[model samples]
Target: MSKHLLCLALCFFSLKTQAQQSDFSNINFTKADAIANKYKGATLESLPILSYNLTSTLKTDVEKFRAIYRWVCANIENDYYAYLKNKKTRNKLKKDSLKLATWNAYFTQKTFKRLLKEQKTVCTGYAYLIKELANLAEIKCEILDGYGRTADVNIEELSIPNHSWNAVQLNNKWYLCDATWSSGIYDLNHYSFKYDYNDGYFLTDPNLFVKNHYPVNTKWLLTDTIIPITSFLNGPIVYPTTFKQAIVPTQPVTLHLEVKQNQEVIFLLKEGNPMDTSNITIEMTSGTYKTSVKPTINKNSDELLEVKHTFDKRGFYDFHIKLKEEYLITYTVKVEKK
Candidate 1:
């Protein structure tokens, strides 16, 4: 059998997921990598039929969804380096909005074609192509414009909205997926797209998704309470799959974080298995003062730890959660004087 068939075979029939929230944790990364390898440089028109066939073998919604999700991640080049490829045509307009809108309009149409021709695209193209191609397999999806967090930092005040991702309906609920992030990440130190498989993005829960993605329209959140953009920016920056189980940040965000400096900001964590008063310590290193503290933990209950701190200056702070004498996640916190 061809690698494509073998990948589709293994990926399609084997995935068993729970209904509470769709889990992409145990996704067939090998299959995803194989499929990506096959279509790596193939343009949109080059691989539509191939993409459809890969999904046609799968009968369930989740199966079809994963097939498409994996395929996109596999093949789509994030074009993080696209900026280096100077466009043949340049729009020298006085208004930045018009220029952005013009380019956005150009790329928004026939996205698959552009992806094929260029062999790369940004997050918008990734989202558009997913929705477009997934339609062939009869899956419902929507592209969402949003503000996204990057590399342990959340800047709520980006002058222009800088990111795009997707939401798909699964079992009557909307689940978030970021194909671009799945494709790869921009290496900040190197200034390049380091191509890799990042399956953490698929079918993420709304609460966690909200931390990185604050949709322009609140209606797309699909959560009980819509989080204001301000709160999303101020919340703790969580690394992939770390401390999510043992730590719950309160919202408006789950983390009880007030990002302003000179205020007593509270961090609340509800201890889970192996997370207890004895084994856990919340450690802090503040950037402004170039000093560190092991904050006093106030136990509100057996499961709850309310960590409090006040920043004297405006700068970045790093908070590391140590459980059982090992570091959990050193969550990034930014303190600004309001």
Candidate 2:
């Protein structure tokens, strides 16, 4: 498969979600959230009624959409086993287009059954349900298939599309969101679903959204920045908290890096808010042995933070940054003796 080119139409949707600027601040979601909480355990028998119950009393398009989005995130569970199976099959059949297409077609049916009956699904099911509910409410929403980059995704092995999200048109403007990421996280240690609602994925900023999500269709890219597939793949692995905290990694554009002993590597970020530098910590792991470091954090300004860490030893290491004990982003580095 050829590399998917990305041309984000940044100019067209700048005001919609530029950097840290959000148009949703003034819009109160109390009513919509309350409604979602009230209807916490809704079934999927009738989408129209679900949509109506979620939106009829809501005042605005965004609020209406929020109610539906929140309800789905809270009620539905991410099928981790199914997700693993789909990923394995997709990777195995990636080289054969015919077989891959056939498998996708067959699995889609099973996915729907699991979603409707058990309230469990993967990314595709989440996107489908969102689109169906939005369509029932006469809201403009679409399912977008593309690559979703997490720490586990090997860029070299990315062939078939591995994820799906949603694009919404509200008030004559386009917005992007991923209910799958927002719903919760899969506990890797225990191998179970953890219900942690992250609202950052709701109508996310295109600039930050492009960090991990690349839609198959260029038109869905609301930002105008031209990001190549290589850059998208090489970028650092960002977690949901990265978006929630409005922290964008500006330096070390690539995740993998090489440096000599005693060489210094700089980490830069554009913060959405003035964060306490003391709350940040960098942990480096080389194989089973792990160690933590307190890098010198300097504020370029209220919104720009810089971190400097020098490699004193030679090894292949994985670096993780945490803010207030929440994971923000990760990078891999190789240090060699001079």
Candidate 3:
């Protein structure tokens, strides 16, 4: 082989190797395994069972909501002995039994297994376990790294670095709930088993949370409204649908789709007919245009085709495309009022 050709081949191989190495750094499966391992050998406790009457009354939404509530209630206990046991092992201990800071630290590092085996953890550990359980139940929850203020002292401002809690979204609203404060010692024996589902903690006014807990994502503290996942998915795509928009007099709107590769796509329209037999027009953007034309409008039963050139002149217009038989995808674009 020529000397120049050998250099070119070596360069190509180096580039290939670099690309492969970069892909591995993007994933962190090891961290997840480490977390799981920390809780190994922990005894599995039977979760609290919902009341028979409550179970019968639960509908789809109610059932999902109740499942999460019951899981938290069943797994955590309010035993003072458990707290004392955990306090001895963990460091940076707080002398005050009611200190929220102590609770957060214990929960964050400990696992459910630790809680079951040792019967105690700090506040952070409790919050972490709660977050994990909420995730398992398919609920969206996040831990807020912030300080808490009690009536007695402004420990947070004193740089005491106290407290941790969770903000959960339910029915499109963010609610604050502090299981630690609620479950902490109460009566003489510190054996009070009553679980308080305090509304004071739920859908808390932002002003209140800001005074005590400065969340990492301040947006979570701004409103009770739970941001929908669809809002994020509705943003721009690499290959968005192209269409003509107008406003004066109602007229039929046409969308032109361009497919660069040979792939099957579920063609959809937000405001145009996907199944109009007589009024719709379909044409290939590329390739042998005539051969690529679809005969009769193919529409899925779940999809409907309707026209609204006048009503909705603003907002996004989305369409689906299936590329080759393997890839199903969609693209979207915005239309301004004319």
Candidate 4:
């Protein structure tokens, strides 16, 4: 059989086996039933026939396939990675090889149900499972091979094909989703599962993946715009002050400021107590005056407050602000220098 035909056969066979093994008695098929009921007028009796008999199904088509696919994705747990990583539980998965070579070899011998029952498989195994489920739901999906880069690391430097994920067609548009990435994995250094789901990476903009992910087949990327890692890492710098000059009277001007991305600021005066709130307030003629301000923390913090004052008298004020944190944040303007 042709490769495409073989893949299709595997997909259908997996679905048939999964349906037979699935314990639907425990599942509240009410939703699925309700979805199926929409086609009550149709003559189809079974799911497979209804799914493949496009002419009849499309007649009552309420897009139940997408619903079923989403439900499965939401319900399935990606625990293989975590299970293999734990020393105590890792032994159980010993039968299931972690090596990519072993996984590639298994796909040739095992069907989806067998691999799933073994509770061990590699990236290809996971992708195959996804394909199986998608096929059952009649959702068009494809497995794409690629390398995933750590947040700051570059994939181009890596020598091995380290990751795999899925591309799903929804609403006539393809999106990338990584179930493995969705599952929190233990970072050896942190010793805890860092559970962060970046939907942006799931079904991402083809342009954005080019800079980080080098798919075996570039066609899967689907976009020409290459977004640099720096573009995502280095964001716009929001200066504390948007204005270089402001009109103020010497009485005592209070400047209220906030920073975005939750950054903290430390206000310093060249001639006043750094901690003294009163000293931070200065009186000058009706003109602009310059004061120096700096941030203390190197990371963004929650919303905070900092107050600066100039008396009713103002002159040309020159103030300098230095970012103490290396994150992008926004500040709110509470007080006006004018």
Q: Alpha-carbon error at 104 in model 3, in Å?
A: 9.7
lDDT of 3 by residue, 139-217 (tens): 6777776555443334212324445677665543445655565443346665555554332333334433343444445
Can you write out model 1's per-residue Cα lDDT over 256-293, one digit (the tens) per residue?
34377677766675443334455556666664544545
Task: Choose the strongest candidate by lDDT.
Answer: 2
Could you tell me which 10 consecutive residues in candidate 1 have the lowest summed lDDT? Answer: 13-22
- In model 2, the runs with Cα more than 4 Å from the true position are 1-21, 188-191
Instruction: lDDT for model 2, please.
Output: 0.85
Q: Estimate TM-scores for all models.
A: 0.66, 0.89, 0.38, 0.40
TM-score of 2: 0.89
For model 3, give the 10-residue run with minimal summed lDDT: 240-249
* Higher-lDDT candidate of 1 and 3: 1
Query: What CA RMSD would you report for each candidate?
Result: 9.7, 5.1, 21.6, 18.1
lDDT (Cα, tens digit) per residue for candidate 4, span 1-338: 99999988865444222111012224443455454345433431343554443222332212443333333233334444433443233234445657545654544355344444543344555566556556655567888887555433331244244467777665444555555554334466855445443333334334334434556665565553433434322322121111111101111122223233223234321211112222222222223534333233221243223433322322332222322222112211322344
After superposing all C-alphas onto the true structure, candidate 4 shows an RMSD in angstroms of 18.1
lDDT winner, 2 or 4:
2
**Arranged by lDDT, best first:** 2, 1, 3, 4
Cα lDDT tens digits for candidate 2, 287-327: 79798878898877654688889999899999898887788
Q: RMSD in Å for candidate 2, one decimal?
A: 5.1
Candidate 3 local Cα displacement, residue 46, angstroms: 7.7
Total backbone clashes of candidate 4, pairs 3 or more residues apart or in separate chains: 36
